[model samples]
Target: MDGTLLTPPKRSARARGAVLGALMLGAFTFNTAENLPIGLLDVVAGRLGVSVPATGLLVTGYGLTVAVASLPLTHAVRSVPRRHVLTGVFAALAVSSLAAALLSSYGPLLAARLVTALAQALFWAVMGPVAVGLFPPGVRGRVIGALSVAGSLALVAGVPGGTWLGRHGGWPLPVTVAAVLGLVSLVTVAVLLPTTRPEAEPAALGISPDRRRFALVLTAGALSATGAFAGFTYLVPFLGDVGGFRPETIGVLLVAFGLACLAGVSLAGALLDRSPHGVLTGAVAVQATGLLGLYAWGARPAAAVLFLVLTGGALGPVFMATQHAMLHCAPGRTDLAFAANSGAYNVGIAAGAALGGLILPYAGVRAAFLAGGLLAVAACAVLLPGRPRPAES
Candidate 1:
């Protein structure tokens, strides 16, 4: 009945699964690239001859670029074939990582990171839709769930692995490994991903239908992230100064925390689609409690590690809940909502690091946890009234 249907056999399930695996690897590679620096901040700063706080500006700047560029870059690439766009992003990231490895000075390294941030922004914006489109509707949820697992595993593997490599091999080793992963991801995508033309008009920036809900969701996201990252970005310092962890021991602890994060993601995925608001509120409450515990007992090694695990566990779920909330609240504007959410997330990252940097010298590391807990409480307050609306009668 249709020439197109008969033109060629569809890809086999095995082939499709391999493509999906490649996409997941892309997710893993990109996340690893972004998070690699987190574990190597001190090493990077020391090697580049900059103060640690000034080194923090690298994280701050990268997040700011992603927040600023996500929407626009996504719009620019909306009409491009998904395969080419994804492949290009991976290639760019590979090059950026290589530049970061080779650059001698802090300025050039920072510049290279900024370029990577641009590619990362577009990658996050488009990755979901492309992944979902590759599968039938009936299997989409599974595909996304698997992709999320890949992302969580990136944390499981990337951060600690990078830290270990950096400790033994030097700062460049971790980033260089990230570069290799990026290249592998690039080739996988190019060879495996089928070209898919845009199915609808590109998502654009516009006023959300429910302004109050949108504002609340955005604020909640920003506040929660600020709370988490304030302490998280400085976690290595906290572990050394407060928890009394040796450099090698810190890597093991980070891996433990990453495992908790994976569990949190799994739990959130199970719960969020049912009640986004409840899950978000509960996550914030738990996180706040954990941060407060860390603040009070961080001087004790066991207590600090316990609280760290709890805090890490809650982080993933909060992100999942925020994404779920944004999608549910915005009726026809999922794209705009996602973009706003992404921006809020990164803005919170910058804000948290800046806030922690300011406070670390003045008040102390414990105070950072206290401040972060208060921010989480603030997020809870904003989200209290933001239960998803009842279905239309």
Candidate 2:
């Protein structure tokens, strides 16, 4: 037998759990590294003697690379063992992070960031199918939910912690730790992931697939992301100007919002398998309600906090459910479809931020939340009425 799985399901529950944990660690590390620059833009800029805007390119550029390269790279390695491919990617990410730390110049570090982005492209493409493959199909929703939780942790723990370290110790310290974390994930996955024959049917491919439903899933995903980020990108400005929150208290609020995100994904994992589309529609509705409520009531501090947390709660599930739904609804190859979804999500992030920026100059920050709320509502519209439900794969 091929080695994609190391043991029979009945015997390897613990082993499967351990491997899933390693995958979770890798997912956390990759997501953290991708967004870490945002929190440390100024710190990184000062260390490299560049402007903060220039340092911000590290993030925007990385997203561009991943969005462009995800499908091609995922296709190229279609025949490789996932265990091998993922471990290689982790090794590459580790090297790139180390390169960023060692190189002082902006040009060199930017090159390193691109390498990390390339690795991340393929990592996202495979990680989902791989995670679900470890468990029985009945639990796929829960599997995605668990993975999304690790990703959410990156926002609350990894990004914030890196920012704190950079502010105190230096930028390179967090960058180096990023490398260390990548290496740790690399070793763990290499040891635990099962070996496999290259010719074996991929565990990650869609079983009961649908192109129309898949298109609907992608549309809903991109729209929801666009809506959420439009508001999220301007959270601080909205809080400061509308909610009258102080800088110190905003951090606490953010931490609370992050915790709410954790709760969202956890609930999604519990309920997604039971009714996938229903959860998707409901999450988007909840997100829209929060944004709309924020736009209408954010002038009051207590109401602002409540709606902000409500939106935060839905944000994690909105996108998490998108990818989970994709696992069953992929139009073609699951990995390739995943690549497309990742690209769309990244595009959504860029679009939402750009749109919010444009709105801020003309309509004000409150208008941005209103715009976001409308888009999320539109996402709900995309998921319901005539949309065909996909069969569980």
Output the TM-score of candidate 1: 0.82
RMSD to truth, every model:
5.0, 2.6
lDDT of 2 by residue, 1-393 (tens): 222223233427777887788778878888888898888888888889999999999998998898889889988998898889989998999999998888999999999999999999999888887777777777888998998999899988988998888899987888899889888878877887777643343445565577887887888888888888899999999999999999999989999999999899999889988887778889999999999999999999999999999999999998788888776767666778888888888888888998899999999999999999999999888888635555642
Worst 10 residues of 2 by lDDT: 2-11
For candidate 1, list the clashing residue pairs, or say none: none
Could you tell me every candidate's TM-score relative to the true structure? 0.82, 0.94
lDDT of each: 0.75, 0.85
Local distance difference test, candidate 2: 0.85
In candidate 1, position 90 carries an lDDT of 88
The sequence of per-residue lDDT tens digits that candidate 1 reaches over residues 1-393 is 111111212666776677678777877777777777766788888899998878877776787899999888866766787788888998998999999988879999999999998988887776665565555533333455576677888889767678899989988888888788788878878887777554332222221245677788789889999998898878889889988889999978888888988887777666654555677889888888888888899889889888988898888777666655544454344444666677788889888988998999999988998999999999989988766565200
Candidate 2 stretches with Cα past 4 Å from truth are: 1-11, 197-202, 386-390
Model 1 stretches with alpha carbons more than 4 Å out: 1-12, 41-57, 135-145, 167-173, 197-211, 237-251, 299-302, 331-333, 390-393
